[model samples]
Target: MSQALAHNIIAEADYLATEERASVRHELVGGEMHAMAGASERHNRIAGNIFFHLRAATRSKTCRAFMADMKLRLGQGALFYYPDAMLVCDPTDDHPHYKQAPCFIAEVLSPATAKIDVREKWSSYQTLPGLRYYLLVDAERLWAKCYSTNATGQWFEQELSAEDRLEIDCGDAHITLTLNDIYEDTGLLL
Candidate 1:
């Protein structure tokens, strides 16, 4: 969530309509619209790296990967968020403007959104029945955290450094990502 546009509550339909024509992006949360801030170069690079890997990994499979421009609808449209990167495998979740269910989601943390991403989004995302993996990547450092659900529906956390490789199982396909792949061309590895 970003900064609230105003104290007034906006209807979901109205927010969607306004967002369609609005120059800037806004997320609807608890009936209030919050204006999203622009990302830094480093943030964009990190997010792009994640998206690139996810897209390639899911290309031959039924899954599709999306970047920040795609909105993820939650809480029956009461909460809408734009994740840095996400993977959706369910064919029924084909909304033109937003996604209702995602199997995997990644958020690259920045100074402004780190707290909300770690606390608010983390809490909300876990409530989704189809969500199996949630990744939090640090933009300023070579660190990542992954929360994955097991067969028993219990969630476990794993912390990764530059040398670690992350393996994700996406039903029919499995994808592996390394810090070198994520931080490539960002000058972070240098």
Candidate 2:
């Protein structure tokens, strides 16, 4: 789902201010605009499953779990990214676009966008000051990998497998996950 930026129909700033609530979502990258692709049934299911677990796990905490449709306004240095799922622990979750610093974010990868998720998207998400964990899920393989920021602020990767139950430690709240749970009904190749 990659497309060349159509001739600059609107300036990045103007695009931001206008149609902020438009039905068709567009992402800004170095001023180039690319419309988002519609989700497939598998895509929707994976996102739904993750959010469901996150919501229940964080109910008593200050963190809020959200589905992919929520816009994330990554600040100046990066573009606005709409992750497949996100968790925000910052008290500023009231902001429009869910611009508040999020503690965790996940992207369900499709073959068309896997590189972007593993590279560009991963790089952009890491820039968020308050971010702690980043997870990448492979739709075709049903594989999951996570990156957690260490005490010195550097991020480290952790790989999760079907045999092992995974838990994301988020201070007061922890999100327990198993790869099999997300792909239960997907009938994924792997």
For each candidate, what TM-score against the reference? Answer: 0.94, 0.86
| Candidate achieving the largest TM-score | 1
Query: Compared with the true structure, what per-residue lDDT tens digits does model 2 show for residues 60-162?
Result: 8888888877767775623677789888877766776545588888899988888999999888887788888888888777688989887799888888876
* Residue range with the least summed lDDT across 10 consecutive positions in model 1: 181-190
- Against the true structure, candidate 1 has what lDDT? 0.90
lDDT of 1 by residue, 1-190 (tens): 7995657888889999999999999988899899999998999999999999998888778888999999999998889999999999998999999998899999999999999999999999998899999999888987789999998899999998767789988766577988888888877873
**Regions of candidate 1 where Cα sits further than 4 Å from its true position:** 1-6
lDDT of each: 0.90, 0.78
Winner by lDDT: 1
